[model samples]
Target: MKKQRYALIIIDMQNDFVLPDSPACVAGALATVAQIQKILETCRRIKWPVIHVIREYRADGSDIEITRLPEFREKKYCVPGTAGCEIVAALKPASDEYIIVKKRFSAFMNTELDIILRRLEIENIVICGTQYPHCIRATVYDGVSYGYNVTLITDATAAQTPEIASANTRDIRDIGVECVSTFYFVNNIAVH
Candidate 1:
């Protein structure tokens, strides 16, 4: 595929999901962070658009979707006022980066992510982050639905186990998103 103006939409990279010690943190979350850092560094060097999509719930949980699962529904994980809502320091966003705090699985749902991407004229999206079955999958579908050429950096996203991760990755590919590895993406970008 030809390179276009792409936005790196990192989904749910907040402390609650990314830090290994976080209450609701998925196992192997820290490893995903390391992969994200590598992508972030390359994006910075290449001057690509980098957007961090966080899930910041309301303090009273009034704004949350009660229809979702209990793990995500009733629990107030990334409450807006709490530190768990903040992006991890390892992948701290720079001044030029875009930060979008969303309330749902799809980053474009009731969020500024779509507006930001449009303003940047970004037609391609390179998606990478935690929990492949959840936010990652949701964001990829939304990216495609919203008319962005979406690609999932397979090695840059992870869940609790390799089996689940592989299955999730396969599901994403079946939906028509190009699922490529981090090494393939970064190496090409480095030499480009």
Candidate 2:
């Protein structure tokens, strides 16, 4: 059998989204930090490629989406040179890991994520990170659409509420993406 090439894509784990006190905080995001850390450690140990996908918007809101423009302009977050735009310290990328800056929800949308994965010859993508309804869901869908075997670490990905997380997990699973816990993934999938 041909070996399965895997990569870990961590989406939108920036201070703006993961910090509880931040303006753009996702309620459940802070809780997933330890779980995401576990996954990150495992990936680093196993020598799998790790990609941190962060969201950034122009301070002027000129590049933000139409629906979000008003809010973004009123309360700026994820702008360059701001602490909120940086990836959370615990999950910061190592020197060799990849960091992708995305302006939109989906990491693959207008980003170098797809091409980087292709260049790495990655066939299986393990995804984790915040806000299930938007960034996480969109990236998972696009990962599948891009013809990669996508796996979601349920405990490591977050949404504003448990209901939203569960609902999105169900929808993602319905599309045939593997949804498993951090423990399960590290013990089973990542081992091989």
Candidate 3:
């Protein structure tokens, strides 16, 4: 069998979501940085396409979701030109890598992600990064809906709590998405 063409997508690993002191921090996000970094390194070594998907909003909250607007006005995050909107330093995209900025939970929503993936002829996507229930879940489901094989690197992804992560993982797996740890994914890639 031929090795499937795929891309590694690192989603929402930004200061606002991953830093412990950031206003929008996800409790478990900080811990997954290292795991995400590991996967990033492996992908870079293997010369795989790496796409960094990030969330960004206008400082005035003009582009923020209507449901999040009230809170966002008070506690702003992921604002453009701000450090909080940047991808965490540890997993910064290389000069040749792609960065997709999204204003919604799903990276594919109104973004050029699908176009880029299609242009690359990518059939599978290995996803990782912060907060499972929202961004991760949305992106994974959308990937499936778009007819792409999706793999969620469980350890490289995070949620506010382990319980939340576990629950989301089960739900994601039930959809036939491959959910594996960073180690397992890296090893499996090696074997192929």
Candidate 4:
């Protein structure tokens, strides 16, 4: 595949999801942020499209339905325009990069991600994000549905458990997506 025609999507690498004290933080999520940054730097240097997706909820807890999770609704997390919803400092995106705000686990749901990718003429996607089973996996499926060659960067993503990660990786590959390590993907691109 042509690496130049691909984009790097960094999903939900936010404070509330990576920080230990945050309400919805995942374990070791922060560990992969540096790796993700390195990927972003390389992509930027090569002028590849970079898209960052973030989850945002309403502060008053009004946008979030308590019925979805009675316990979670009470917690103030990822409120729209809040600090917790902001992406981590280490992966500061450039001004020209695309920033996608998604309300649900699927980044393409009710979002212009598909349209943007189409506009960019992107045929393949390199996904690197947090919460593998949730947003990252969902996005990968969506990418395939949109006719993009999707590659999951395992080292740049994290989940609640190893089992979940392994299962998601297997599932994604089962559907024709390529699950690869960040280093391997980068090396292949370099060789290409």
Q: Which predicted model would earn the best lDDT?
A: 2
- Candidate 3 residue-wise lDDT, 80-111, digit = tens: 89998888888888999999999999999999
* Evaluation by lDDT, superior candidate among 1 and 3: 3
lDDT of 4 by residue, 1-192 (tens): 644478889999999899888988888588899889878988988789899998777665555544545646656778767778888899978999999998778889999999999899888889988988888988999888878888888888998888888888899889988888878877885234
- Model 2 global lDDT (CA atoms, 0 to 1): 0.94
Ranking by lDDT: 2, 3, 4, 1
Distance from true location, Cα of 36 in model 2, Å: 0.4
Off by over 4 Å in 1: 1-3, 67-75, 189-192
Taking all chains together, the TM-score of candidate 1 against the true structure is: 0.90
How many residue pairs clash in model 1?
0
Number of the top-ranking candidate, with TM-score as the measure: 2
Runs in model 4 lying further than 4 Å from the true structure: 1-4, 65-68, 190-192
Pitting candidate 3 against candidate 4, the one with the higher lDDT is 3
lDDT by candidate, in order shown? 0.82, 0.94, 0.91, 0.84
Query: Candidate 2 has what TM-score?
Result: 0.98
Ranking the candidates on TM-score from highest down gives 2, 3, 4, 1
Q: Write model 2 residue lDDT over 17-53, tens digit each, in one string.
A: 8897898999999999999999999999999999999
Residue pairs clashing in model 4 are none
In model 2, the Cα lDDT at residue 157 comes to 95
Candidate 4, residue 124: Cα displacement in angstroms equals 0.5
Worst 10 residues of 2 by lDDT: 65-74
The Cα error of candidate 1 at residue 95, in Å, is: 0.9
Clash pairs, candidate 2, are none
